[model samples]
Target chain A: MNLLQKFCTRINLTKSSKGYNVSVIALLIILLLIGIFLSISIGSSKISLADIVSAIRLKDQGSNNYRIISFVRIPRTIAAVLVGCALAVSGAILQSVLNNSLASPNVIGVNSGAGLFFILTAAFFPVNIYLSTIAAFIGAILAVFLVYFIARKTGASRMAIVLSGVAVSSFIGAITDTVLTLKPDTMIARAAFLIGGFSGITMDKLSFAGVFILIALIASLVLSYDMNVLALGDESAKSLGLNISRIRFSSLILAAILAGSAISFAGHIGFVGLIVPHVARFIVGHDNRLVIPVSALMGSIFTLLCDLLARVLFAPYEIPVGIIMSFLGGPFFIYLLVKGRRGQLYD
Target chain B: MIKLEDISSGYNKITIIKDINISFNQGTITSIIGKNGCGKTTLLRTASNLLKPFSGKISVADKPITDYSDKELARKVSFLPQLRSVPNITVYNLVMHGRYPYLGFSRTPQKHDKEIVDRAIEEMNLASYVNKNIQELSGGQRQKVYIAMVLAQNSDIIFLDEPTTYLDINHQLEILQIVKRLKQMGKTIIMVLHDLSNALSYSDNICLMEKGQIAIYDSPEGVYKSGKIEEIFNVCSQQLAVADGTKQYVFYIE
Candidate 1:
């Protein structure tokens, strides 16, 4: 066989192999360990790796340093990892459902919808983080339904759905800007949160969002095969006995839940959803069973690295996680676009 | 066996098919041929339960099609629409999806399911391209992969709309042969064919449609002798004799 033939065959064999799952799990574990270490070491204090491990083990040499590492840095790190995983899995699911390369929550307006609701809750309720999270979740769901309804009339064209999402998101964003502009007292605080950061996260809020992300992640993994089947298109899926409407609706809801929960806590971080899944799919192949979990791990690692940079690169007066991610993810996205245009990645 | 009784189906308020009645028997090949906009694809879609009928009933194996759960209906009936763009997927995975009705939450293909998929692939002579991505193959080869997928469903009844679209002459014959082979295996196959000679040669029964209703549904000889072809297709044609009692139509362009 030619080299291309051999490569294609090897990919096909790996996709069908049982050992595929084992290898992915192993990679995920390694990434998790690396992410944990990076999250602990990269902060204002510049703790040593040994000190960080000792602090995690509760065998600290001093109280002040231990408290800083355990209470402050650990929660932020946990929040970053969970939110990263959530966004990545959500992106994978959205791409599969819409069958488009550019169907991430940020691009398709799911995040914008949630962000608008979050802004509303912040403006009106002022002090209820939990209520804001719920409001965001509800808003995300409503936006998805609106997009579905508008696009359904056009026979559910992927391009039409994406365009509708963009239109609706911009409209909602304009409304959010109007509200923020009018409420001068809350404007700066809301803008800071909107810029996306995990710096001020508490253990309670992290744990709260973590539970939702965990459940949604498990649900996404379980439905990964269905998502793969769906990529074959709705007609083929129906012939295979899949309830197309049910699967699409449930998977979209699951993705919205994960993304909405993440945005509620971490604000609207970009690129984790858009870039991580595409990169993970390139590494692991398009079998969602592997792609979903692998993307989650890759997302965690990418976000941890970006968050680390955000904290230490400017030292004290930290950069927003969103800005840092944009710096890294923007170039990666451009590379993907160029490769896709050349027909190297897609073919 | 599949039966459609006075079926009327279409998008919302615009009815495309009007009270159409048709029945297809087990272990036989049937073809529905009609002009553009005559509702052949719509009829097939409704019969396969992809589109719900505005009125009338479709029954599969003595039960209403709508009454059967999605999985239950899939095990009994399979439908392949007209060829469009094939995604970059392997032939093996495409065929394995045919066993999706039997898969549960675990989504693991059983040994028996794998065996069935392999047999279907072998039957289509796609073993060489089994591991090749579908988009890398020729149009005919891709069509065969999809046909193999439907066959792997192992349903008693199968429906295909314009299965020969985009295929070369040789591949068209290859596909017709595979459909014939499926019939020999006791499958009830219903397909839409644009070529009258192919429909007349391969199908045991032919349903010639005009506008939104069936002009005639009977044996090929019966429909040919009824002078309905010229009436329906607006083409002048004569049936020529072939060995083994099969006849071919020669169409004359005015």
Candidate 2:
């Protein structure tokens, strides 16, 4: 047999998965770096490898290439990566903590929560990045808590949580729409925010949300081990001495921080949370320790690639990255359903 | 090793198990047997700290159970809940989670933890299935995997709620054998069992419940002599000698 076949058979023979998991993660990290390079270089302005290197080094700050890379593309690229990492990790955590595969930041009303609050903040308050970020975080928390409490009150089954999330999401979405209808002045900002694109992104907008997302991502890695236990069900988790409520609450808060912060800057970017984690699990199996970091890296790469496609797919007219995401995510989701692996994976 | 006093616990406001007081001795197998909804599961859950008693005091190792942290309590007792999702994890990984309470902040499995997991997998005869996804396993095999996880916990007290439920006769016997071996290892075993004959055959003591109250807590012989099985279950009981030279209680509906 060839070496690849030998390795595949070995993997099936019940060997330690750490070896394969580590290799998979390392490979993804390398791919992510390549993806970032591609995202930076392949924009409408056609910034080359040499230009990106020089721009990042500030070797020729006055050059037009440096100006485009530094001011526009750099901030946009970083925002894509951060937003991707945050949403994907948040979805992974929510899926495990809620023990439902359907649980995602978008599916569970967390994104709409942040979106609603961001809209309200943008309308009433001055355009303060910090205030909007915090408001979005609080809004995400409020929405998640609402969904949780509603589900709990109505029998906290797995389906109940998802059903409650749908109910809460539409309600929050309607509120946001109504707010936009009342204040036509906010439509310009709300339009781009709703579609979710990298156009006009700035370092100032990403700064606060970036910090929150980084801290929340680190916290998620720390808590991933406990999350594995939590996925075993409440009774098993509690029996293993896990504080089920504490872990679940902390996980939700971290997820909120992630989804909330990302949407605070990136707008209601959908499908990254819902799709990337499933893909990550497909690659790395179900260990959250492996799933979380893999999701983070894969999320960054997925968004970066999607953003790249959005930039070049139409030469003069740039579409919102969220539109491209829906175009891809809708088909991928149906593919997962057609594969019939969902039951085997989540059961 | 575990004690409960004036325990009343249930879902929401309604009390299912009321005014129960019982203690489990170490190095023995005690099976809780009762009709459905008689709160046998609740009593087991309450004692294991999975369900908080509405009003009661529980002590473990002569100290209040509340005094111990969750990790400490986990190290003291391992519980196999009746309801659990079949997580999409390999057998080895799932069994390793039994060492959660023993790990430090890093949560990495040390050599000691690995050795225990190895022994547990070996004990459960799960060596061949270590790398297989638990979802791929049969009902009996999955039950073995879960039991291996509990064994890897290595707690002084073990709580299993219907460990043999839904398994075929062969697998059920195998699980009972493991429980027997656990008692031989000097660990306390508390389980809720629906099979009266199996409980009588396997456990040193049987706690019979009726209407959420402990009707009898005694040796299997004593419980059988009390004629409570026939009275409560509306069944006839016969003591027969098996080829193994042990008396087995067989229950049949009249």
Best by the DockQ measure: 2
Clashes (backbone N, CA, C under 3 Å), per candidate, total 0, 1
lDDT (tens digit, per residue) of candidate 1 on B161-227: 9999888999999999999999999999999999898998899999998888999999998998898
Q: Write the per-residue lDDT of candidate 2 for residues B196-236, one digit (tens) a residue.
A: 99999999999999999999999999999999988889999
Per-residue lDDT over A153-233 for candidate 1, one digit per residue giving the tens place of the 0 to 100 score: 776656677888888888888998898888766676567657888877888777767888899898888888888788888
Model 1's CAPRI class is medium
* Residue-level error in angstroms, candidate 1, position A200: 0.7
Candidate 2 Cα errors over 4 Å, as ranges: A1-16, A126-134, A148-164, A336-347
The C-alpha local distance difference test score for the whole of candidate 2 amounts to 0.86
Cα lDDT, model 2, residue A293: 94
Candidate achieving the largest lDDT: 2
Q: What count of clashes does model 1 give?
A: 0
Clashing pairs in 2: A14-B131
Q: What do the candidate models score in CA lDDT, each in turn? A: 0.83, 0.86
